[model samples]
Every structure is written in structure tokens, then in C-alpha cells.
Target: MSRPESGAPTTTPPPTPPGESPAAPLPAAGPGPGAVAVPPSPCLSKVELRVSCRALLDRDALSKSDPCVMLLMQSRGQWVEVERTEVIKRNLHPVFSKVFTIDYYFEEVQKLRFEVFDINSSSVPCGPREDDFLGAAECTLGQIVSHKKITKPLVLKHGKHAGKSTITIIAEELSGNNNYVELFFSARKLDDKDLFSKSDPFLEIHKLDDDDTFQLVHRSEVIKNNLNPVWAPFTISINSLCSCNYDRLIKDQPGVALWDRGASLGRDVPHADEDLASGPVDGCG
Candidate 1:
């Protein structure tokens, strides 16, 4: 066929056959090559990060270092600890079950730091702890969720060179299944730390918030003189517990000393100095 006097636009479809309605032009094709590839959708989401460490150097003399991992996020040019995993006693390679939930903003570069500490004595729940420092790793939350799982070598503060310590992380977006958990927690033979009477032990349940603060969700009654006590069952929202995320961890810590609140016998009463009548616990429960 002779070339048309004018070239028709190549992008336009061929004219439809007569008596046939032109098929609706194919929906606009997706961006072609060199067309600035559309960046991913703005990632405003809730994600749970699970962490683990391997090949950690033992900081203890007698046994392996009791290691726990703390996760800190960069906030206003400063890194603040958001959450930490439970201490794994005498284990060089610890797979922490603690899941750190956080809000992911793709627009901003969200920096993160994972620090490993040999928690010999101090057992603070969250960051800025006074414990033996092991090593750390730094990365952006975007890096983690992008790869889904990543492994990075551990280093000292300020990215100082360190040994074979390394950490692995896995990221997962949260689901919308909101549920509550009914848990009955108890302590068996708690340590005694009293001068005059049995230790008064109670439980303080805490929830980690988006602002990186552990807010006290509930407090159990103080059970006096009972070392192994069964606390009443409690109901906590799964969302409150861990934002309804899967595979969350439950942590336990030693309760602080609460002096025995009991009646002191008068001098006339020949009662031993240790004889402390536990005060009425009617209101305690």
C-alpha cells in the first residue's frame, strides 16, 4: 500500500471495521520504560520486627553471656530505645521471641539501632540500661521491610569495629484481627527481700506504646506472706498487649520491695520483733 500523505499517530489504534463499535480504547497502559517508574505507595503502616543474634562474644567468665537485644529508633537526631527482648540466660546465640511493633513512615528515613547487652545484673525492661555492652547494628526501617529479612554484623557504639557478633531481623505488616487475651500469671517462690516479714509481692502489667513508653495497663493486688501465689486471672486486650500482632512475647521481671504493711505490737505485748501481723488485706484484693 502507498504511504499515506500524513503519518497517523502510532499510538492510536487502527480504525475499527465499519458497523462495529470501536472497542473502548484499551485502558491507559502502565508507565513504560524511562517513564519515571512510580515509586512505591506511601508506606504508612504498622509493622512487627522480630530480632535474633548469633556468634555473640561471651562477656562472662563462668558461663555464656546473658544477652538481650534492645531496639532504638532515631528521633530528632537522637536515638531512643523503643523496646527490648527478654534476656536469654547462658546462650551465645539467642533467638528472641520479643516482637517490636512500630509505625513505619516511608516518606521519612526511619533510622534504627539494635544493641546487644550482656544483662548480668541490671534487668531494666527497656533502653538506656546500665549493663555490659556487647555490640550493635544500624539500619533504616525501610531497608528491613524492603528485604523482609536482613542480617547485619554487630558493632560497638558509634560503629566501632567489633567481633563476629551479628543480628538478624524479620519484618511483617500487622493484621486487623483485634482480640483480647485472658492470662493467669503466677510466681513460684519469689526471692525474699524483707527485713521484718515476708515479702509483699504484686504484679504490674505494662504495655509498650507507639511513643516508646511502657504504660502500666494493670496492677495486681499485693499478696502478702505468700511466696508462691496465684494471682487472679486478668483479661488484656490483644491490641494493648502487642497491637494484635502475631508471635508477641511475654516478659517477667522482679517486683520491687514492698514493706510489710502490718500492725506493730505494742511494747506491752510480748511479741517477737519479727512478729508482724499482716494488716487487713480486704482492700488489697
Candidate 2:
């Protein structure tokens, strides 16, 4: 290029910087130097401990007169019970539908079981042998495992100290034979999986007495797999079937106080006379 005369100025653009590519955008963020990504929290596994007259029993022939729901867990090594207190009194006009929710804190769950006992006839057989005057008892029991909703086994992760999960039991009497059921729960790792096996869980129940003292009325060990933990669910009933006799005592002593008087029952003991019947149930049907 030639320069003009005295007043003319020379003009030229500066060169582009080295290492700068005109066509390329800045590189997006990539993995940091030797940094590992953290894994996500594991999803919990759950099962609907469902029981229905339609699913388990014949409904058309069932009767409301014998409406019932009974829950039992195998605690320690014995069978302890949990029954509906209302159903015990409403033998003649029982409520048909009932449900309960149970949560699991991952551990040993002996067994979780449900029983629909018939009390219409005092002679109705109940229990495992089903040959007692208590009534007829039918039940379902099992352990917790991966279902269609949960394929990957529930994990407790390396840093997790404990795991908790809940199950909701919904029941509609529909016709008769009051529906009863429970969530039989247990836990395990994905690598070492056991299916439909039992888990042993523990529970404790304390009842307050009239003397303002707390007493242990029942102790359970492990019923089966989530079957029953001697310590957890305590079945108690105060029926008025023979209260007329106790009424005579109530008349003699105003404000008659009959409380739970017994030694501390442990999860290993199924039933002990120490867990005595306080007095009598004092309500009208």
C-alpha cells in the first residue's frame, strides 16, 4: 500500500489473538478433575397388605351378626394377638368394615397376620385348630418382598442409619364377615434376597393402673416373619357378657377400681396368668 500526501493517515486492523477459534463456542462444563458423582437416594419398597371378603372369603353367606377383625403378630417365638375392641362387644350388630396402617422400621419382623373371627355363636370355633368356643378364625400371613411397583430391593444406603416405611390397610365390609387384613413387613438387601420368609420384630406395651402405675400386661417375642412381636401390639378386651355379677360389687364399692395388675410381661412370653383379667367389661350393647 502507498502512503498519500502529507495530511493522509495510514489505517490497518489489528490481528486476531492466538488460541482463539472464530467458529468454536466455549466448551461446556465437563466432569471436574477426578470428581465422582454422588448416587441418588434409593426408592423405598412397599406392599398393600390387602384383605377383602371378596378376595379371601365368600361374602354372600357371611353375616353381620358375627362381624369381626383380629390381628396377631408372632413376637419372640409365641403368638400374641391384636383384636378390635368394638367387635368384641358388637357381636350382634358388628361393623363390617375396618382397616389399620402399620409402619416398618427395617429389622426383624416375626410375622403379620389377620383373622376374621365369628362370634355370632359362642360356640363358633376359633384359632389355629379352629375348634374352640371363641369362634371361627380365618387369616392371611406372609413376608415383605419386591412387588410389581418395586423391583429394585429397598436399600438402606451406606450413610443411612435407619429405614422406615408405612402401609395403609383399607377395608369396606361390602356385605358381611367384616373384612380384616394387615401389612406383613420385613426388609433385606438386593444382593442377598429372601422371598416370603419371616422377619422377627419386637414390641412392648405398657398399661396404666388405677394406682397411677404403669404395668406391663403383655410381652411377645416373634410370631413369624412380621407375624407378631411379643412387645408391640397388645390385644385387650373388657366384655360385659358377665358384668351383672361385677355390678353387685360396683354397688358395694363406689367408683370401683379394677386395674391392670401384673408383672412385666416380656416379648418371649405368649400368655401369662400375670396378665390377668382386671375385672369385667361394663358397657351395654
- The candidate that wins on lDDT is 1
Best candidate according to TM-score: 1
Query: Across residues 1-285, which tens digit of lDDT does each residue of candidate 2 receive?
Result: 855567444444345589974543333355668899886654332222322221122122443223344566677866678544223222332222233333333343436554444333443344322321122222223233322111111112342311221122322111212223221222222111114453333222333333443333223343334332222323322211111234532343212111121222232122122121223223212
Model 2 / residue 96 / CA error / Å: 5.1
Clashes of 2: 47
After superposition, which runs of candidate 2 have C-alpha atoms over 4 Å from their true positions?
Answer: 1-50, 55-65, 85-96, 121-285
Predictions: Cα RMSD each: 13.0, 23.1
Candidate 2 local lDDT, residue 33: 82
Whole-model alpha-carbon lDDT for candidate 1: 0.65
TM match of model 2 to true structure? 0.25
Candidate 1: the clashing residue pairs are: none
